[model samples]
Target: MYNALMGTAATTAVGAGLTLYYLEKNSAHANMEAEGLHPADYPFPQKKLFGTFDHASIRRGFQVFKEVCSACHSLDLVHWRNLVDVAYTEDEVREMAEEFEYTDGPDDKGEMFERPGKLTDPIPRPYANEEAARAANAGALPPDLSLITKARHGGVDYIYALLTGYCDPPAGVEVREGLNYNPYFPGGAIAMAQNIFDGVVEYEDGTPNTASQIAKDVVTFLNWAAEPELDDRKKIGAKALLLFSSLTLMALWIKRNRWHTLKSRKIAFNSPKNWNKKPNPPSKN
Candidate 1:
């Protein structure tokens, strides 16, 4: 009984909370639902050459990661093995794997093994643990970059947008207390300052070391991280669905043609069963 009451109360609380949130954001929510103005609705802007992923661009992004963000943030979910899917060669991946240090010890035979990193090794944290990370980043632990493209409101597009959106606060916009001035952040300010800046990292790609380029390339790399096989997955899914749909349609057509006969036969068979199963008027009592 107590569990039932608790469940009821929890459901009521959730309903009430949702009601309040909806009331507060009714206009935005309505606009998003009706027009798909939500984060995932934003389309990735792609051109023939500049927008799409390539080796030079991803390599440049790696350079950016190494020079800037990798000091604090860690992409714990992404393994070095996955880099091959993102256009890295096996040798390049091996070379990259050597950069990260991993922990391993002797086996039962007491033979030492070099267990720094491998193709299958997940990205390790820069800090020892969450407590250490929080202590360094002013109480905000840096999020893993592996799933960042999908986790954010606009996915890769949002990261691209946010990176390029850094600008001066608009005129007449009241700067809220405890908030530094920013126009692009969803909440007008973030603890993280302008991350992408010009001439920050020297790219081996020979592209100009502009903040905009870095931001765009990094976002592209992140998109790759989130869904490396998205195109292949989508293609396979489409083909499978088409086959299933065709089979279903054929089955439906056959069923439609045979429905009357099947129904008649079922009725004929069911009558005897019903008659035999009947109570026989309770033995005429």
Candidate 2:
């Protein structure tokens, strides 16, 4: 009886695996014909600027992160060193680095040398590590933000949408007991609360006290955090493309010469002057 049950379970597992594999392989093709939805289709307002970092927006985002999100969510993948790329001067970056305390220590001088962060310091976490985070969140781990802009769907668009998309008493929508309405979220709901509010964090930059503005600013910072080298990368890509085109032209020239030589050899060998007899052409199937 046990063996018979095991055989049935194995067959079920095999069938499920095959079904999953088929769906995975054909998903892209299936979606190709489906209409793609933008973030604006939901309650969220999409960002005006994308794929490029906005300094003002990022600066504001830093404030939002410090005030609210940083309380529970930690940016472990980001280092103090990486902040330099977001238009922060070396001095500003260093000052920012000192704000977060880290794990490493100094040598035998007996004086605690404060670790001044470099451009590569992975952002330290409030928790000791992932295990601690999981424990706190009821096993629901909060993802690292360093690569989230790239990792999430719609990438930056998705994040910006999620931030501003939070709302209470969502009309025409039923939310799960614990989950809150977040129109920007893929499923239109999330476990996290609507964290942003007007005048939530006072800005020295004279930026307005509005939820939308704050969300946009924070999203901008996240985008820059994900790709500090975006501007430089664009420049590098352009240079590489030009170089590749030049090399491709040279390769074409070499290929032309090689083919020309082969054609000449064939002509020389098959020349009427060199061949005394006519070639046979007729064949029966």
Best by TM-score: 1
Over 138-177, each residue of candidate 1 has an lDDT whose tens digit, in order, gives: 7777787888987975576667666666566667656554
List per-prediction Cα lDDT, in the order shown.
0.70, 0.70
- Clash pairs, model 1 backbone: 81-119
lDDT, model 1, position 152: 74
lDDT tens readout by residue for model 2, 210-249: 9878877777777777777776777687789999999999
Off by over 4 Å in 1: 1-56, 106-115, 170-180, 237-285
- Give TM per candidate: 0.61, 0.60
Give the distance in Å from residue 175's predicted Cα in candidate 2 to where it truly belongs: 3.1
